[model samples]
Target chain A: MSLDIFKERGTPLDRQSFTWKDMVGEPYSKLDDDAFTRVRQILMHGVEQESCRFKHFAARFNPELRLPLARIRRVEHHQATMVNWLMPGDQSTLETTIGFEQVAIEVTAHVAAVEPDPYMAQIYRFGLLEDFDHLYRYAALMDRLCGKDANNILQSYTDVMPGRPTSVEHRAPEDDLRLHYQKTRAAPLTKIHAALITGSEWQTRDYYLTVGPTFADPIARQLYAEIASIEEQHVTQYEALSDPSETWLEKWLVQEATEVYAYWSCYSQEQNPRIKLIWERFLSYELEHLRLVRELMQKLENRDPAELLPAEFPDPLSFTSHRKFVRETLAAEVDLRARGYDIVPMDQDSPASIAYRAQLNAGGSPSEAVAAGYHWRPGTELTDRRVRDAAFAPLSGQEAAQ
Target chain B: MNKNDRPTDIGINRTGIALSPLDGPLTAEGASAAPPSSAGSWQDAAMVRLRYAAEASEFGHMPPPATLRGLAKTAKELLKGHKANVLLDKLGERLAFERTGVRLYDGLIVKFEANGSWEGGPTLEELVAFRSDEARHFELMVQALVKLGADPTAMTPSADITAVESLGVLQVISDPRTGLAHALHAQQIAELADVAGWDLLASLSETLGHTELAAECRRALAQENLHAAAVARWLKAHAEVAARGELEQAVAS
Candidate 1:
């Protein structure tokens, strides 16, 4: 169930086609499908988006690449549609957001565990805990505001407890920047991980910005604003990990390789037969994308694609729960703070970040207010005997009169 | 030439004050003062949409029956050369609405707890009972659908559409900013829909010759009618208190 990225001739770029009906086929069952199915969906959509985004930029600057990039970008566009439309309309924005954070937690956890670069792995671990905290905040919102269980989406695969507090995750932009992996020295898996995560966070930030205003709830709106800001910080932090010296063709080649690897991973682990076929079809389509990009790189840049991409992808991403690893990371690294390319202790936290966080919190933290006194219960905190009885009982004065 | 369909035809429509000799010229002058921001066919936007709309698939289809019993029932109905599936479809729709209705009540109850009830508003106990009734009604639908060999949990076409229709009210009720009165106003919307849903289900069941299910739906409809009436009264109380400028005093009292 491994894929050879350098060898597989997936559906040729000319053959990558979709009708609107095929693009928006039946969605997975919200109630019955595995949560990991959704994890795969959100991640693949983000991966395709980043490829499309990068190709467009490359087209702008590199005159020779416009037509090839346009052809590839069109397929990437339809591929993104087919993947994202698997999310049914029935899942609310907040509930789909729950699925988004699950992708963030588990996928980042998988990469962090396997990344060979110690510095890059630390970056993944740090981002992992922040997303884990987001799941907790949103789970509380879902329970308190929506009166629905987030575990219904989470399926108990990921924990619903806090990680590093999101209110404190706000840092100065400079502090958010991290050291780049050397293009010559970084593992193939490291480059793919950076692109995958940066793209996923970018889409998340954009999704929140787009949908945040549609909410009439003031706190939910503020919560989306606050969280989307952190996602922006994440985009800054993770995108900086890729070496700046890599040429546009070099970057494009790696982007296609990342898509190929991600779809391959999804195809291997997909449980739903229908969605699995989508993953299968898209996997071949990406392989062809990788083949075309690799050929273009060789022709235009005179660099062998074999020299850049691995003959075989590193192990497919682990789609299983990382609850133990996540909890252990929270226990160990939750206190780690950023200080200009370095994760450090609170005593070593950058002064600029402290001042920045202070100004932001002066207005009151929506993350804190939304989760104040919030404890995750099986159903909700309202199900707790003390809270339930008190909540359902008479008002204080009314009780006194009674 | 067809005036309406002609893109640039200067039709004589008096929607504006162009007919008024006094202010019409002034208003028309103000309208023409600001140039359009950019010039392109608005058709550019509409054409892309038109193509997609022409090419789009449906929202979804009814899932095939999960069990042989269900498949046989569906097949028998189809063979009967009748619309037996229609009854089960509407039943599933009712089932989904009642299930979400239970959660909607739960969200409203949380709103009540944080922002306490006003004078002549719902008691904590009454809201709890409302939630209970929703739960029971949804379960009743589940039983009824199963007895008819339908999947109670499937999002029927009508079920999916009902969720879309009710999404706005759910958002309002779930908002932490909304007060008890605001939540009751939203609850009244749900109650209104619930009463109609039950009424239709009862009549549909009777027409389909399910007398027992019809009677049960009638009972649920009665509960929904009471809910609608009570919710309307509570909203009026809150509205009147605001009108009297005694909302703070009434709530405190």
Candidate 2:
């Protein structure tokens, strides 16, 4: 559906309410449903999460927009709950961690492929490789820690291989920032991508911070710490990608339009009928939300919301696997490193980053420890019957005793 | 810091209302005096549960047979009374349980190292031996599933639920703050459940006429009972030491 954000009057904010039963509805199946279903759910949950977070922060700053912001934020809180609670209880923390990484890898690939600006696309691909490497590391953790195949969670949708070595992805704080888009000249989609991806990484960083300590394994704990740091860096880069010069209302306007785009994307491609209806219903709710925010923008600052939104939304973010694009990106840019808003060859990495990473790795890296000589076998290391990753091979009673 | 401080040495654990004195009694009185928020019984929640339960789908389905020989075995079993997947799914449950069971012991082993054991509690060798048994049993379950033409790697619905249940067992054992006895208490819970699981699994196997598999399950069951007994003895001994002699000193503020 070609949705003109400015023209479509979405479901009224008053009607966007939810019941206790409705908000805590049935979760999507981890086994039966497509992996991309979880992807859409996780990303959109992040999107709504950001919506609530942005409004809270915006309310602290904008005294005039506070009430409408809270009105929209209230609906958004329910929206976040509805989306996040859709993850089935059966998916373990590590298993769900795999799903989160899949979102990063796949969604970033799509954004990178479609992002028009060369530098922005390069940044997306660079971050893409780092997250790609994360899936491989977490896949290793799932195998080495639990003896389960990551593919079971993956359902063969996303590949489990290193893109950029996560061990090397760490950098000094300054290197993590990127050049923001020229807000006036940048495509509306560019602003949308920045908001969406930044929201995703922000939620991811917070998730890892929350769940990291729940793990008992020092390896799992440290891997989360390590990767969550990169997620922080990701939030930094993606958040910086947006021009900071835009007004509070302008940013808020863009946020609402992005939600319209995201829900449209999910509604367009969702396969499960029950979940599809949610995306469809929420799409209407978000349309109304966009309208509410647009009205607020007009009244509060007399700004034209149309200037922030495109006449038509860009192509709905593709929810399909970009295995080919990912592999191609890996081959072409595995050695690329971030050096203060510039993507460069590994040899050109900033010395400050090298020093920072060296101090962090002085003790030894958990990502390397968990995946030592590890490969993604179809069945986990345990299932290979002929030869197992001897590191995890079963010990006889006497051997264990010794 | 008390040089003689032990995990079981009770300090200021102010959880119970008796410790809270005035506020605790007042809180209890207030709760009893409070009117109901809504006009309904507990069945209100039950009805909600029932509605959701009726609407809910199966946690998951069994995958197709990975091998033709096992497929033939499953087909033959289907010619009789029971569904083949039922047996396969239970076996998969045990496979997952035993796999996680190994990790539980791995965590306990680290606990054994970090906080040394008591007079009657576990030894390093005992922890290692138990872990080995779990690993070997996991291997046995995997082979049994393969023999039944089921893919061992695929998590059956039962396997998924069992993993969900193990999460709590895992949490207790993995927690460093938990005492060695506390960790054993957690494992003993698994052991009790493991004993029942193996017994039921064996009986099911026999009823289904899988005699060889039943025999192997009985062997694992016998081993599980031993583990449970050993854990019980150790816990009892550790508790008796605290309760009999040092009981006052342990609790004294």
Clashing pairs in 2: none
- List runs of model 2 lying over 4 Å from the truth: A389-402, B1-253
Best by lDDT: 2
Candidate 1 residue-wise lDDT at A351: 95
What residue runs in model 1 are displaced by over 4 Å at the alpha carbon?
A391-402, B1-253
Q: What is the CAPRI rating of model 2's predicted complex?
A: incorrect
Candidate 2's C-alpha lDDT? Answer: 0.81
Q: What lDDT is obtained when candidate 1 is compared to the true structure?
A: 0.80
lDDT of 2 by residue, B67-120 (tens): 555366554654343467788888999999999999999998987776666656
Candidate 2, residue A181: lDDT: 95
Chain B TM-score, model 1, reads 0.77
lDDT of 2 by residue, A1-402 (tens): 588776777788788889989998888866667778999999999999999999999999988888888988999999999999898766789989999999998899999999998889999999999998898889878887787877776666676765677778899999999999998999999999999999999999999999999885567788899999999999999999999999988898889888989999999999889999999899899888878777777887887888778999869999987877987887799989989889999899999899999999887676766666555665665655533533332223323454
Q: What is the Cα-based lDDT of residue B127 in candidate 1?
A: 86
